[model samples]
Target: MTGDLILYTNPMSRGRIVRWMLEEAGASYETRVLDYGTTMKAPDYLKINPMGKVPAIVHKGVVVTETAAICAYLADVYAEAGLAPAIGDPLRGAYFRWLFYAAGPYEASFGDRAMGIEVPADKRAMVGYGCFADVMNTVEAAVSQGPYILGETFSAADVYLGSQIGFGLQFGMTEARPAFTAYWQRLAARPAYVRATALDDALMPKTA
Candidate 1:
């Protein structure tokens, strides 16, 4: 808990997701706000992550990249934060499922839709997301059974999925299906989420 935590990020990017995770973990961290243009392509930051992406972390001398990986790592490292299910717990499997699903299918499908890329139904198996409709339907079914992803208890999976749903609704990229609407409400009620979002809001410009 006494080690240095340097989070390289831009306030408006996916880095915000890791910010929520940091708040949920109750960990002390420093933000090195990297702007999207030349700053991200600079040599020093590129060494940390070849992709030149934000949401990368340097904790206790180890560097972690990728938003979902960072979130999962923080939850496991700060076990007392109770952001993850216990190792042998049955819920652990489901926790991993949603986390990976959000990073994989959900993100892939969102990009495909936004870019207007169409995958033929016969070749859908070659695409990671398969189909946009399938991805949406699966997520809707999962959240509909919830107060949380694993039922009853909140976990890091909720942070990842909840953020996706929040973004989806904000951009109208995905429908406000009843289950997603309910899940979004549940996640918005979290004190940590409120605090993190307020902090992010303060750091960035307000949009109408």
Candidate 2:
């Protein structure tokens, strides 16, 4: 908890999402952007994350990988940020609900669709996401109840789900349903989100 917090990332990758979470947490950290195909696959970086993935973090000498896990971990460790609900708070259950859902079902189904892979109906149960349409519909319903995932309050869950929703819109992977549109607008209004996005944009290639 006391050591230097180091983030190994590349702006073009999922590391950008963790960057948003870091900004939202208001925690001090340093970023080391690893170039893809070179630095990222280098031995030193791979030592931090065997999979050679971006968005890995080192805090107090401990390493954490995966975007969702990093988001949840940072929110809890920096409790004063209020990115997460307290342990006994009723919203805590709902908090975990959307967070894991985004990481699990949402991403799984989206990946399947993006890759043109089809899951047979009978085998759907074995796959957490079931199907792309089901995942999108579930998200549409959830955002419809919004302003945010927790209704009246915005938390780290928004950082995860909102970013995914935004990505979906940007790539035309999902339809811009009314609820998703409004929720994304609200998320974009946050100062932290704006600042984080600006930083990422600055790092993006001119052609990108």
Candidate 3:
């Protein structure tokens, strides 16, 4: 994709995650904030994403959807930013591993619990996340050995996974485990994370 990316987002949604990714990549982009039930569904926006989701991006006329995909895309295209592992690096496998796991089992497991959806014991094996406790335990151990997911090298994978943990803890989807808290503190201190949050906060609507 060429030219400045156009990010279609809502201030109070998962779009914040993508905004953080954009900032991390030092991407040149413009934000188009969509209202909850209106502009998001308008024909123009629908053309970009039929699901009417916030956090879609248009780069050189190519549309990118899904938060994880967009984050990875930016990391790759902006290779100089060093947000991703180099292609031939053996670490690339582990890099993609945690990134997808975060969006998959990590998110679905806790999110299922938050919405009061309980899986029967026998059915747990069939589920991707298995159980919330197991999922959290795995994540905690994953970060406990880290300065970053790649162990000393901060990359885009941390951005996605760390954001999930941060949001999950903030809204009760996950517990504030020491490992998770420490990981979030490291990520939250990044200038990009701070800038993205501030930019999004400025876009939020003021309440009376």
Q: What is the C-alpha RMSD of each candidate to the true structure, in Å?
A: 1.7, 1.8, 1.4
lDDT of 2 by residue, 76-163 (tens): 9889999999999999999999999999999988898999999999999999888888998899888888588998878889999999
TM value for model 1: 0.95
Leading candidate by lDDT? 1
Q: Give the 10-residue window scoring lowest on summed lDDT in candidate 2.
A: 1-10
Q: lDDT by residue for model 3 over 137-160, one digit each (tens)?
A: 988888987789989888889989
Candidate 2 runs further than 4 Å off: 1-3, 206-208
**Which candidate model has the greater lDDT, 1 or 3?**
1
Comparing 1 and 2 by lDDT, which wins? 1
RMSD of 3: 1.4
- C-alpha lDDT values of all predictions: 0.90, 0.89, 0.89
Candidate 1 wrong stretches, greater than 4 Å: 1-3, 206-208
lDDT of 1 by residue, 1-208 (tens): 5449988887789888888899999999988888887889899999999998787999988999988899899999889999999999998999999999999989999988999998899999999889999999999889978699889989889999899999999889989888888899989889889988888888896679
Q: What is the lDDT for 190 in model 3?
A: 97
User: In model 3, what lDDT does residue 198 have?
Assistant: 99
Better candidate by TM-score, 1 or 3: 3
